[model samples]
Target chain A: MSDLSDERIREEAKKALREKGLKCVIGWSAEGTPTFASTEEEIDRLSFNRSCVNNLVPYLTYEIRSQRGKTRDGKDKVVVPVGVVVRGCDSKALLLLLNEKILARNEVFIIGVPCSGVVDPRAGGALFRKCVKCAMRNPVVFDVLASETVQEDEKDYSEVEAIERMSQEERWALWEEILGDCIRCHACKRSCPVCYCDECLLDPTDVAIKPDTTAEEKAHRPLWVERSVNVPENLVYHLARLPHLVGRCVDCGECERVCPRRLPLRLLTTKLEKDVKEIFDYEAAKEEGQKPLIAMSCMEDENGFIM
Target chain B: MSKSILRKDKVAEALSALGKQSVVYAPVKNKRGIVEYRELGKSASAAEIELDGKPDTPPKAIIFPQTEVLLTYRKDKDGKFEVTPARPDEREKVIFGVRPCDAIGIAVMDKVFCGGKFTDPYYKARREKVTIFSIACDGPMDSYCFCPSTGGSPAATEGSDVMMYDVGDSYYVEGVTEKGKKALEALKGQLGKPSPEQEGRKEAIVEKAKSGEGFTRKISAESIAKLDNSFDSKYWDDVARRCLSCGACTYYCPTCHCFDINDEKGGERVRTWDSCQFGIFTMHTSGHNPRAVRAQKLRNRYYHKFKYSKDNIGRYLCVGCGRCIALCPASLDITKAISEVK
Candidate 1:
């Protein structure tokens, strides 16, 4: 579908929120709305703007746990269910939550739309570069699919193919070149939906290697070796992020879009996803009840190299 | 000693009959030597078992799935929350043709999940309901198998309830548990008892496995105890630099059991697998990360298996199932790393 048609779907979602007896419809709207108007208004639906790029599931979780009720006069006042609008990839996030037993499936109303994909506003251009090549133009697991027709065309992974064409040394060189600009800001991690760790290992205090040491001293320390944005550090950092996405990353391209340097983060994830499918014959969040590809093992699993 | 001599042709009929009585999962070959579990249809042949070598994936998938719904919740209009248990169907399952190393891995997992303070009821329910029918490995399937060094034998009976050995013209089955006795009793009258020669053949197979190059790498378990003191050792940095940290090693490992809990509100909650190898695996809400670098993250993966799990579970988390050696893109081998640890 075109940009004009997507706006129409957004309007329909707004109309659904305007219906009677609905507590609040959660949909994307313009950014910069006043917090009071966004939360306290008695309007039919709540819309987020382009900054709403983060999956609504995490925010919904926060709301469900913290704002679900109020105590008045020693009695509890009930909070209404929040209606959420999700795209195909967003729906997969919701499904993963359900599968993990973190959230009940029936608590929130999902308005699923056939997503043509959304532009990452953090890319700071006409649109996020990755959005132009996105394949999931239509959502698969939505309660209310916005599009009538599904786009089943094969995604052109030429961008990844272009990188794959390079030799291993060349690929490593490219990664080093890109990661050299990393400030370790971790905006990419914070914006990710699947990155729901209670404690991140990057925090020096959490793992407690040494918090008082200088960067130069820490860099030479055995535990802190390869911790910088140098080639070795960048390679390790990039490699460390791949398994987190196994059977979970929906190829949303959110990380790349949010990166300050616009490093091709999605390519690394997508390449791993491709290998996972090829090696294990599995897809991440493709089927509702399908097992996480990485969790299961067999005794007969081929171990030809270790012997 | 008990022995049965069924013609190779009758093996299919025997397995088919067994399937009629219980849930039977066996390895079926697909492309690229990949192995997957398929229901044993009435006419399914034993030829589908692929006993010539190890399957690409382990049997842990059958018992401990990658992702399983633990419970479901519904919020009534009255705003009261109701939780519904999501349990797997109670069915007696027989995992036929499991390898010795894989079976031991399951046994290790059983100790970890079942004996812990927080019992995984889902895993327990499946464990209590399933019976393992282990097939002894006659020869090394690949170079990555270091079963000998890690206390694994090709034909070890450490985990299997019933151990099976393939003789030239017949199959010999021995009962190692009461469950195996009952299964054997059920199969009585259709087979001859074990002869002295069959028992001799079993010993020969076990001996062959013992002498193979499977134990090429000898790691002193005591050396792993020094890992705590070596926390800041340069060894981790060297390994971490080579590690892609892609989690293939942990994910494919038979004993790595870290997971993450998430709430997907349609009204239900879910929990999925998490890996310690990721930068965000231990990320805290306060915006601090404990394993910010690949070196630390990589160190956690080994230290947890060798030190913490041994302290808690009474054994190293690794069961000598050498998946990490075979599937690593960068050729990072755990056995080689462990050999170099000291």
Candidate 2:
């Protein structure tokens, strides 16, 4: 690991914040509660902790935009130009936002850091359950580097690799075994960083998943499918949840780690991620300024399937 | 009674004059064959413009950015919440050399933003202020493109404020709306009266766009409507198995506009974009995900595009842009699904 002290990093961050035209600096600070903070000075906050796991890019949506508030004189303050701390993966989100023109490059100052994986609280036991299989420990796009940079071993995809080793029938049976526990609570969706819709189709009142007794009875009753968690409905429920991450999932692994049942959620996502890389030769959040695979097109893209 | 022909060589001068008048965004090449919109400088070359092909990125970035700050709020000294409106950079922009499919995509977004009960004021202001200059595609630039399948011909003039056709050495320009007429008037000195051959060339290109191997994946609008009732159909499982749940289809789609909104505030409210294909999209606070599995999520994506969106908006959410078919990791093409929906 490259030896760079956290103290040195905070000193640099403080210096950047003091620069003229900067409104506020966004970085992770370990106040008794571990979360991202927008602070005016380094001394006012505690130093970074390994548990500062939240992606800071999401905060920019509100920090830089004009919302409700007024100065003491009753005049509105200008939209604050923010300075953000970005890791390699987080920088991709920033690049996407810039490419989308959501956040103007001039509006926010980026401090790119080469990350050496973050600790996930869900993965390495209850304390860090989400940190066990982090692929991007190194920050790809930091203005100032922090932490000792070390080359970690390649991630062990043994869980997904084992699933791949199964025959088609075994795989289907495995999914059926896992999905049989689903209760249709949307906890996974709520915790996802990318699941940002206004109205969800699975809402209780959604016409698509009709609440009418007749529709429900006809749909689940005939197949000997239990309205409760029987084999069929559970399988269907599990199938419904996986596709939502397609190109947008950055392998943050938040969904799997957050699952209360500890259903092998990461297995499903990792399998898809692996397939995407192998089949389409694409990786999610792999490059800065690269458009998400689905948002782009090429004249040479294979279209043998399209009639 | 105005027909103007601009020689291909004078295009830069015309663009420069237009840039002087307003912000002009044109295509420029990056590392790969990637074409992205960059501000047109005086030295910007017309040669960089790909009139026939689709850019690697969509034009939606100019309008509906990925992470727009809708509004910001702060606490006052008295602890009262103060709301401030995001001051948008309001400038007249002219988006030049957009393909027919992308132009239709913008029009589709117009329906979503302007035709809905809640008007997205941010999107509306940018869209209304900007002028679209569409370049007609003379032929299928990629095999995956199925603009004709989605009621869009490559040369269709459905969405452009102004439509341009390249005929040999000259570009035939026509005003599709009053805004286009005003934009054309800004370049009066560079425009020449059109010759009969230019008109003939334009027609020929239009004919070529129409006559190519039109998308063979045909599904009746009536059949798509029946999808809501056909939940037990084996097609869902068959297709879901092949689908890697990568969400390439919806993200690249011109009309697949399902999005999630959430608050990003460390302690306050901030909303950002979300997708439906994710298992988390419908997960409840109580730990119940109504759409918990891949099959249901995949079905929702198809139903949203083919059935639900059509029911709500009177048009299928998919515009046959073919971006999904081209980019899907598993090669699970929606066109094939539509064809197989018996």
Best by TM-score: 1
Lowest summed lDDT across 10 adjacent residues in model 2 chain B is found at B263-272
Per-residue C-alpha lDDT of model 1 across residues A195-262, encoded as one tens digit per residue: 66544544221233344545665345333222222455455555676766776777766566445445
Query: How does the DockQ of candidate 2 come out?
Result: 0.02
- Each model's TM-score, in the order given? 0.53, 0.52
lDDT of 2 by residue, A92-184 (tens): 556656645566676777766555555543344243433444556566555666655545446557878988889999998777767664433
Q: What DockQ, between 0 and 1, does each candidate earn?
A: 0.02, 0.02
Model 1 lDDT per residue over B157-222, tens place: 876888888876777788778887667665664556767888788779978987854455455655
Q: Please report, as a value between 0 and 1, the fraction of native contacts recovered by candidate 2.
A: 0.00
True-vs-predicted CA distance for residue A33, candidate 2, Å: 48
